[model samples]
Target: MKYISTRGSAAALDFEGVTLAGLASDGGLYIPESWPRFSDNEIAEMAGLPYAELAVRIMAPFTAGSLTEEELRGLCHAAYGSFAHDAVTPLVQFDQQHWLLELFHGPTLAFKDVALQLLGRLFENFLSRSDDHLTIVGATSGDTGSAAIDAVAGRERIDIFMLHPEGRVSEVQRRQMTTVLAPNVHNIAIDGSFDDAQAMVKRMFTDPSMATSHGGRFRITAVNSINWARLMAQVVYYFAAALQLGAPQRKIAFSVPTGNFGDVFAGYVAAQMGLPIERLIVATNVNDILHRALSSGDYSAGTVTPTAAPSMDIQVSSNFERLLFDAGGRDGAALAEQMRGFEASKAMQLTNAQREGASALFTSARVTPEEMVKAMRWASDHCGEIIDPHTAIGLYAACSMEIDAAMPIVTLATAHPAKFPDAVSEATGQHPELPARLGNLFEREERFDSLPGTYEAVRDYVAQRATESA
Candidate 1:
């Protein structure tokens, strides 16, 4: 499958090229040139398949020219083999219509592990075939740093530099990234919000000097959802949840607690692929640019507000561009012009075509702290499940949306409750403990560097430290 940049200038690329080049050279995201659709019989045939097997079936289309079926299956198995659950992404019924898809079953205990585990392997696999090395520079609000670190730590031919907002992340979240002392993992505490860090990361990708500054030794890449491969792996879970609840015949609705917009976009990909999807609900915390964008066509970003759900406290949703490009009829040049206006002014109204296209299958909700807490309490009192603040936001949206009583609505449980113990405890009066595997996380020694949030500083740090590949 070939991929094209949303900005119409970059050369069309295959899956491997898209994976390595996270952001297009034209400063737009890459998307599949054409979506691959499946027949009803094909969808029906996926039932009862194990998670790894199902992943292979669903992802094979995107990786057609990049990886053979056997190689892809082997990578999937190796990636998911260590997950804490057999189902990989297990579904728990919260009520008759409402259910929670637990995605924190992997080593890092967050939804990102579902993709990054395989992404790390893919990087290793592709890099092994050639002599080129990867210098992965990523910006994370909370979970991505730890999950990406866990996935690539100690791996050959790669060095990762992950930036997170200093003093903003929860204690568990901070320690999770800092405690991993792998030689290849370099954690940076940026003295700014996640949006600032994300902007710097994007700038670094395009800065001409970045390529020549590091002795031209290493190629920079991303682990963020900006990478198409990250979103590709995420599409599998939507299919997994739907098929288990009855798909191919009955439509399913999903409420995703979104900050970057990548996860819900994955559901969009699934629907495009002929899965029977009723709706894709985008859930957000107080940083509700996505909610406002969808609700009123006002796609404007405001100041980032730190909330109980730190991960969702992003004002700018990077993956929103892909949706706009698709909704704008895949006219890359037109969308690129539209995006330039937003980048200049931090605001843009969605066009009629874009709004109408998105309105068909997408809806959004902005959950308040009180509502998030109430959902947490409800889940604990009614369903006997302690949920993190992020999941509570999604659960609130899932319950509030108007859907058929028979149609199952699955809320993506994005993180483990223990990752944000204080928030969960405050909301549900139950202090969720870290699983036994991470029981000693608090005692581990932490290591990371604190850096000013500037592209120059980050670029200099990476240039000096990143190792050259032979």
Candidate 2:
């Protein structure tokens, strides 16, 4: 299998190549050359397998030229073994119509651990075959920093530098990243929104001076959703949830609370791969750029509002470009021109093809704080479930969907309730206790740097400290 840049330019790469090269050289995200499809019998055979084995099967197509089945299986087992739950990503049924897919079982207590755990292993596996070392640069609103940091920290061949908006994240969210204290993990708290940090990270990927300052071996990769491998890893859970709920013979719907579009886009990939999906619900908080884009043709950015769900407080979603490129006829040049226009201004209207194609599979809703809290209360009172603010948005959206009574709607539980205990307590009148594994998180010594939100300041900081690849 080969990966092509969403933009018309950059050379095609195999799985390993794209895994190492996060963003395309021509300023586009990488996507598979074509969607890999499975027959009904093929998908049916995937039932009842363990999570590790299932991941190996679903990811085999994308990793064809890179990893053998045995190799991939070993990596999968090693990566998922650390999850607190045996199911890896367990599903909890609320009622006949609604369910929650718990994705915070891994070390970081966020959905990102599902992918970054395997991503860290992949980086180690690939780097073992060569002399090259990786300098991973990533930006996160909340969870991605901690998950990515936990994944790659202390690895001999990789050094990770993660940036997050300083005061925008919850106390648990911030400490999860700051308290790791790994020498190889460099955490930066930038004085801006997540979009500003994300823009700087993107700029670093293509900056000429960043490359020239270090030697020819200066290698920089990504841990964000901009990396195809990370997004590809996320696709397996959609299949896992659907197969359990009855798939191949039945269609399942998923509601994903996403700001960056990566998690929900994985569902779109599953549907493209012949998984029987009824719809992919794009759930957003007050920061509703994605909600506006899918509901109407308007894809515009506004000021980032600090929300209870800090992870969803993003204006510019990096992975939405992949959807636009695919749904808009895969005409890279045309999409590139369209993207350029959007970058110049902070807005663009989705084309007829893009709008129509997206509407066929996706429906979106924006949840206000009041509705979010109500959903949390409903879960507590009715279902005896304590949910984080992010999951509440998804559940509220799922309940609002006018779908068949027989159909099952799964809401992606993106984070642990303890991660946002204050918000959960305010809504449900119950303070969530941290799991035993993280009970002492607040007692750990924290370490990180504070920097102004400027491209040059961040660039110089990373450049001065980034290890030169050998």
Candidate 3:
């Protein structure tokens, strides 16, 4: 269960250390030294377990040295107990071959809740054992900020500072992050795109001056998928969906509405663990860096364009590096050199090994706005289901991709349609209503800071506000 940086320089660490150190000191993401695999018999044995019990079995290996089995099970139960659905993540059949896995049943009503709820608990559990306090800094295009905030707000030994693009997200998305007035939550609207905000967050992780400025009293961690624990929790639902469709005897294909590439990468991990996966489809909107990178060998990032699916409007996909490192034969030094060139020029060509390795299990689609709308309309008219723009993009890919007709294709429904009401109404002529729990979201008083998109400004604000000790 040891973790190593994608760059070959940092010391190997266990799960607790990697959980706290979001990015390695050498300016690279952390990954397991080697993947943990399961046998087909083992996978079959887990067919009908409850979500929490199945989560313990799937995640226990990764947390071996950090948490005991009982402690892990308790944490999983406490984390998922608040979810609105008994299934946690439910599957709805669209047709004989097409299905939608609804992942917005938790408090924040987005796929991120599936992981962040547990992540917040893990942060508290590990921090309480020692005396350290965490200053969590994260950037989100839409859902991550709200979900992460809801997970950690007012919790002990933690303070969260979240950044999102100002005036770019939908009204519901903006208010979802700003309306939570917990004393430990600080929201910032940065004048930039999600890529700019993400770059600033990464720079802060490596900047020695940020630590010195705070007198080294508090450590900074991340809530983004760059943190391996977030991705680990995500791997469970892939197994859940597959097992429901009779896995091991039947192979399942997943179409993920990917922006950061974290969710689809979880499916890849499931396959690595010997789940019977047919394919992992990476679906994207007009901001299609992932599709371009997979369909061709081009890995260059362009300007991010705002679309109906604001969450998918990201030019740079951070988690793609972990895939490249694995696909490039886990040679940290070689991948490090390649990553540095991409960082300097914002472009790189995929190597033969990387391209061939990824082609074995991954395919991609880039959906236009017209096609996205059409998909939404089709879902409403044909299946009687109104979907958000992001889910529509994924549904489009699932229907159009050339997969075997006998295999079940599950599209990850990443968010609630109510979160993007305007776009859903425009496409389906139906205005989805917010859940009763969030019925009063519009009336809540909003509080947040409008800041210039600079590392110095964000650093000073966090320095002045974060608690020195828990």
* Model 2 agreement with the true structure over 364-404: per-residue lDDT tens digits: 99999999999999999999999999999999999999999
Candidate 1 residue spans exceeding 4 A from truth: 467-470
> Clash pairs of candidate 3?
none
Q: Write one digit per residue (lDDT tens) for candidate 3, span 1-470.
A: 89999888889999999999888888888888888998889989998898999999999999989999999999999999989999999999998899999999999889999999999999999999887879999999999999999999999879999999999898998998999999889999999999999998998898878778776678999999999999999999999999999897999999999999999999999998889898999999989999999989899999999999999999999999999988879988999899999999999999999999999999999999999999999999999998999999999999999888999999999999999999999989999999998879999999999999887898888778874443
Whole-model lDDT per candidate: 0.93, 0.94, 0.93
Tally clashing residue pairs in candidate 2. Answer: 0
Q: Model 1 Cα displacement at 50 (Å)?
A: 0.3
Q: TM-score for every candidate vs. truth?
A: 0.99, 0.99, 0.99
Off by over 4 Å in 3: 467-470
Q: What is the full ranking by lDDT, best candidate first?
A: 2, 1, 3
Tell me the deviation in Å of residue 386 in model 3: 1.1
Better of 2 and 3 by lDDT: 2
Pairs that collide in candidate 1 are: none
